[model samples]
Target: MNLSTLTDQIEQRYHTQAEYPWAKFPDYAVFRHQNNRKWFAILMVVEASKIGLLKEEKISVMNVKAKPDEIGSLRMMKGVYPAYHMNKEHWISLNLTEIEEGLLFELLDESFSLTIKKPPQQRLHKIPL
Candidate 1:
């Protein structure tokens, strides 16, 4: 699935708008939801490559802190890339190449769920600084 398609699916299912925080980096866009004073379920764009033979790679993968077994079990593929800005051993970079839109959306949902699973820490009471 293409970037637009994948992103569209995410928006539809997640009820969140895509935020392009990295404006200077046009290729990147982050999808997130805000609750109270914090933002969560942040799905950031790491890489995008084209599709087809002569096959410009149009794959986009997100960063994840995968478990040891997850990383250890991932078979290295020819054009596969590891997660960006994430611990290489504990994270994985999923290639969206040749993946169906529905499947991509499902994966994105899983990532979003995992990203937001933990609650934010409570702030300690403090006097004006």
Candidate 2:
């Protein structure tokens, strides 16, 4: 589906005020482009080749497929995504496109929910009324 269609579907289902939070994954990034004076957001997941065990099966896998520009800026480290981006000894990137939107939104919802679990440091001093 195209970006607008996907965004519309998300809004219809989730009532999202905005979606940049979905773009915050270190392995994924968001790009906004203006077309005909309108805005569009693209959620791109990066690709990486790494070895990992899935359900105890040893295999070599390619992480998510992302636009070339989006793949170049990822920070690689251990224990990030199952292991890391592309260089870690374990873990892998599951191409967001390969997964169903329902599942992806499930993950996105978890991430968004967890992100708000902590109060902002600046606002920690004030209690909610």
Which candidate leads the pack in TM-score? 1
lDDT of 2 by residue, 71-124 (tens): 333213231233234323322243333445564454444433333334446744
What TM-score does candidate 2 reach? Answer: 0.34
Q: Estimate each model's TM-score.
A: 0.57, 0.34
Local accuracy of candidate 1 as per-residue lDDT tens digits, 1-129:
566776786678877776767667676666665543123223444325321125343446544344556555542543334555655665555665444545445445555665564667899989998
Residue pairs whose backbone atoms clash in candidate 1: 49-57, 49-58, 49-59, 50-57, 50-58, 52-55, 66-90
Note the residue pairs that clash in candidate 2.
none
Off by over 4 Å in 2: 7-28, 31-42, 48-94, 117-129
Query: Cα miss at 110, model 1 (Å)?
Result: 2.3
Instruction: Give the distance in Å from residue 12's predicted Cα in candidate 1 to where it truly belongs.
Output: 1.1
Candidate 1 Cα misplacement greater than 4 A, ranges: 36-59, 64-68, 74-80, 98-103, 117-129
